[model samples]
Target: EPEVTQTPSHQVTQMGQEVILRCVPISNHLYFYWYRQILGQKVEFLVSFYNNEISEKSEIFDDQFSVERPDGSNFTLKIRSTKLEDSAMYFCASSGLRSTGELFFGEGSRLTVL
Candidate 1:
């Protein structure tokens, strides 16, 4: 089955540095989302995008975080500045439709800030 794939499965960066987490969601899915798990915490929603526009975003997705579908198949999340608190396993997900609430998540990109 098709699935989401993320690059740089694990990344270590210094505080104040910038990081870009990339993902290619399922080709047929219509909705994409970025979620994060801070170490042992439960998954938290960061933002949702559809049709090249942001549909909704969480408070956690503040000025520092941005999302884009730069091309047809690739979706991306960019952190303007890395912070210790930003360390987490970021997941890229997609669903065939929004009402289903069923998301297929990627392996996740682990970000570790020093």
Candidate 2:
């Protein structure tokens, strides 16, 4: 079975520092996305990427955050200057279509900012 893979499943970082979460989706998927869930809260969409550019981004994806597919197979999210509020379980997802298709998601990369 094909599934998404994420590195550094648990990350502990100091506030104002930088962190990068990496993911590799199923080989055949086209669209990639980053979503996050605060502890005990609903999941929120952060950004969506397609065709090597961001197709949509939420308010959470402000200037301090960035997403990139440096290699065709790896999608990464970098947080510049982390904040305490930035601590969350960040998920990477992929789909065969833009919408209406099932989104396959990696387990998550849990970030803890102190």
Candidate 3:
């Protein structure tokens, strides 16, 4: 079975630094998303991309955050400036349909902001 893969399972960065988390979602999936979990907090949606454009995004995806599908097989999330509160486990997900309620997720890239 195909699955999402993320690079750098763990990352530690200082405050105000830039961070880029990478992911390769299943090839056949059409929609992709970035979600984050702040330690013990609930999972929060950051952004979604489809057809090479941003489909939707949450308020947490502020000016500092950006998503891109730079090629045929990769999806990426970039945080221009990291903050202490930005430390979290970022998950990359893909699905065939938004209403299907089923998303395939990666193991997650952990980001630690000092």
Candidate 4:
């Protein structure tokens, strides 16, 4: 089955540095989303993109953050200024249809900010 894939399963970065987490969403899907889970916290939606534009974004997706679909298969999340609280598991998800509300997620890209 086609699946979402994320790179650099683990990353350690200093606070205030820039980081780009990469993801390749499942082919043939129309909607993509990014979510983050802080240690001991529930998964929080960061943003959702479709048709090359942002569909929705949570408050957590502040000015320092941006997302792009650089190609037909690649979606990327960039953080301009990381913070200690940015340490979390970043998950990339794709869904074939928004009506079903079913999402397939990558294993996750773990980020550690110190």
Local accuracy of candidate 2 as per-residue lDDT tens digits, 25-59: 89988899999999999999999999999999999
Question: Which lDDT value does model 3 have at 24?
Answer: 99
Relative to the unseen true structure, what is the C-alpha lDDT of residue 90 in candidate 3, on a scale of 0 to 100?
Answer: 99
Off by over 4 Å in 4: none
Clashing pairs in 1: none
lDDT of 4 by residue, 42-101 (tens): 999999999999999999999999999998899999999999999999999999955687
Pull out the clashing pairs in model 2. none
Question: Model 1: per-residue lDDT, tens digit, 1-114?
Answer: 798999889999999999999999999998999999998899999999998899999999999999988889999999999899999999999999657878999999999999
Model 3 residue 11 lDDT score: 99
lDDT of each: 0.95, 0.96, 0.96, 0.95
Shift of residue 109 alpha carbon in model 3, Å? 0.5
Which sections of candidate 3 miss by over 4 Å?
Answer: 97-99
Please give the range of 10 consecutive residues that has the lowest summed lDDT in model 3: 94-103
| Better structure of 1 and 2 per lDDT | 2
Report how far residue 67 has shifted in candidate 2, in Å. Answer: 0.4
What TM-score does each of the candidates earn? 0.96, 0.96, 0.96, 0.97
Model 3 per-residue lDDT tens digits across residues 1-114: 899999889999999999999999999899999999999999999999999999999999999999999988999999999999999999999998556989999999999999
